[model samples]
Target: MPQPMGQTGGWESYPLNPAVHPGKKVVFQYTAEMEVKTLVFTLIDKGHE
Candidate 1:
């Protein structure tokens, strides 16, 4: 899913695919006019480890 960013906001969070498995390559893209300051991948496991 391509989550479009607003012009005024500096941060946003996009929901990851539930079917996403390990070793999958997720691509994050933005427009040329948009400036990317930082990128982070967060994984939260609430189930049994």
Candidate 2:
């Protein structure tokens, strides 16, 4: 499993399994005390194989 680098906000990139679906929706779960101010999900295209 890939762990989050830390609890700070910035740009992050992770290598995902190729089997993962492209249209899947990601969810972020946090405690009431900690708030998720922003979330940016991006998918880069390398062109068709």
Candidate 3:
């Protein structure tokens, strides 16, 4: 779920299953009252380098 951080929209985080295959497709759905300026997605690896 998306979380409201402040006036600048919000962020959401989901834990991917270890068995999830690469190149998997993801879909996001939302409604906004105003024109969305920007959308960013980031993936972080928490395992050891």
lDDT of 2 by residue, 1-49 (tens): 1234355432334444557856333334333334554454544453532
- Worst 10-residue lDDT window for candidate 3 reads 21-30
Q: Which 10-residue window of candidate 1 scores lowest in summed lDDT?
A: 22-31
Per-model RMSD to reference: 6.6, 7.2, 6.0
Across 2-48, the per-residue lDDT of candidate 3 in tens digits comes to 54655545544444454763323232323353344444443444252
Clashes of 3: 0
Highest-scoring model, lDDT: 1
Give candidate 1's whole-model lDDT: 0.49
Better of 1 and 3 by TM-score: 1
Residue 31 of model 3, lDDT score: 36
Q: Would you list the clashing residue pairs of candidate 3?
A: none
